[model samples]
Target: MKTSYVSNLAIQTAMRMTIQQNQMDLLKATQEQTTGRHYDVGLTLGATASRSLNLQREIDRLNSMKSTNSVVTQRLSGSQGALETMAKAAEKVRDTLVTYKGNDAASQLKIQKTEILGALQTFTAAANTSFNGEFLFSGINTDAKPLADYTATSAAKTAFDAAFTAFKTANSITSDDQITVTQMQDFIKNTVEPMFTGTGWDANWSDASSQNMTSRISASEVIESSTNANTNGFRMFAMASVITAELMDKNVTPEVRAAIGVEALQYVEQGIAGLNAERSQLGISESRVKKANTSIDAQLKLVNTHVADLEGIDPIETSTRINTLKVQLETSYTLTSRLQQMSLLNFL
Candidate 1:
């Protein structure tokens, strides 16, 4: 009887252990399929959650960079259009100066000069352009204005005005002398030329060497004299002066009149060339930004995929696992319950 009782008790205990073991196994399996925790659950969750947050932050950063790049690209396109227009205006000035057709030609030259000056002012304004209120062409100084106002009476313009005044004063000039033929020639060669070359007032301007302002003039000395008929300077400056002088003397000679017309055209043409070069550089920078955005996007996609793989559950696999575990646990419980009901007499 004792032997039968011991046998029944052993069966009951065995069934109870089986049920508990099955429950533990099911829990482990569920964790593996769903939560993916073969070891420490808390640590795994923390790591995965952290990684997800980091990936999301990276995506946001890339998106911001893309937005900035878009603004820069649009601005560059506008700059290119402005430069092309300036070039066309300059070409027209060149054509007028080459013809040298007396009063009619001089009149046309004056109109072209006005157009060229307007174009140059536009070009300078474009150089100081901003994207999202941030200056694009000021190099590392993104907040700094690339071009100071030439028309402003502020400290920024003082240096330029002072330099021009010095040259005029050196030539012994006041009022009318400040606007004389010789004075105009000197101002263009000394003041205007230096500003473009990034030597005088524009020395601190960004990308000075790359802009190639000085290279536009084939000969610096020839630009000052009216004798150099082959160079554009003789035609550009001399013609503008002649037109100004023509306001005083309508009988200005054909030779003097033609020279003035040509010089005005040449000056504007050079400005267009410089602006076009800057536009090209801006285009290259825009392309680089686009490439960077693409690269970052790719990286973000990769990280997100990794985070999903680490943390997310597969519903199909989890369901199958849960069903199997349920069956095992139920079988163990039934076996234990039957064993617990058994006695010595029943067992015999």
Candidate 2:
């Protein structure tokens, strides 16, 4: 048997190295115990570590999509609210028109004009509503206000005045009372009607785009998230309101006023229908978003569960390992202290 003498220095160095290693193990075990996840997933799971990483990435992607969906839902809700306000205002005007159509009593006609003007103002306000600094009815041009105010000095009012002046000059009518029903009808058909359609409408009335805002509610599903003032309904609403408000106070015959009422009432009805259609489409999108969120929630739960299964650790096992490492580290420290005291000088 070969006899070898072990030096105290050698034992101390070995014990110090063991203590450092135990400390590292204890730290890792404590972390694993607290998080219930592996400290070194690559070493523990080997080639399958990539699977856990992929699942976590999927979770992140889903979370990002959910965040986006939240914005989409907010925009949709705001759009719906504005549309509701517009629809209600339009409905009120429609009721007024139906109740007083062809009733040319001076006081009654004045009341009707006042109500129509007020409704028009309400419609414009709602159409220009903004959310989060974006105009709700501006379609994809969210930064721009959708509708121009039809005030006395506005371009729309100027254009209408010019159109009416041209009509009167063409018809050789010097006075407002000289405008007969036939002349008025001709003016509306040839001049007023065209102003609210196509380029004329764009130039004078609306700053909104025809293409509405679209949002991706899910990976595979996208939907229109907004409407604009360029729609037929909005055009009709402005047309009816403007024509009645501008012409009702003119010194025209009751026959002519009654004729104007007939045409405006028809336009108001059409406008109401158009607004209803827009509301219906938006409602459908809202329902779809709700369903998409439900699906996303389900996907998130499934992906997170998979990630946990792949990276999870046994808490009991990790805790036991932590305690064992702590004891080993303490023993090493004690041994190192004792070894330091056992020098040849001390023995002497």
- Expressed as tens digits, the lDDT of each residue in 1-348 for candidate 2 is 898876877777788888888888888888888888999999999999899889988898889988988988898888788888988988888888888877767898889888988999999999999988999889899898899998999889999999999999988899999999999998887889899975789898888988999988889999898888999899988998999889977889989988888888888888989998998998999999889999999999999888789899888888888888888888888888888888768878
Steric clash count of candidate 2: 0
User: TM-score of the candidate numbered 2?
Assistant: 0.88
Pairs in clash, predicted candidate 2: none
Write one digit per residue (lDDT tens) for candidate 1, span 162-273: 7656765877766532355554555656665555444443443333212211111111111110011112221232223223322222333445434444445466555445
Which ten contiguous residues of candidate 1 have the minimum total lDDT?
A: 221-230
Q: What is the C-alpha lDDT of each candidate?
A: 0.50, 0.88
* C-alpha TM-scores of all predictions: 0.48, 0.88
Predicted model with the maximum lDDT: 2
Quick one: RMSD of model 1? 12.2
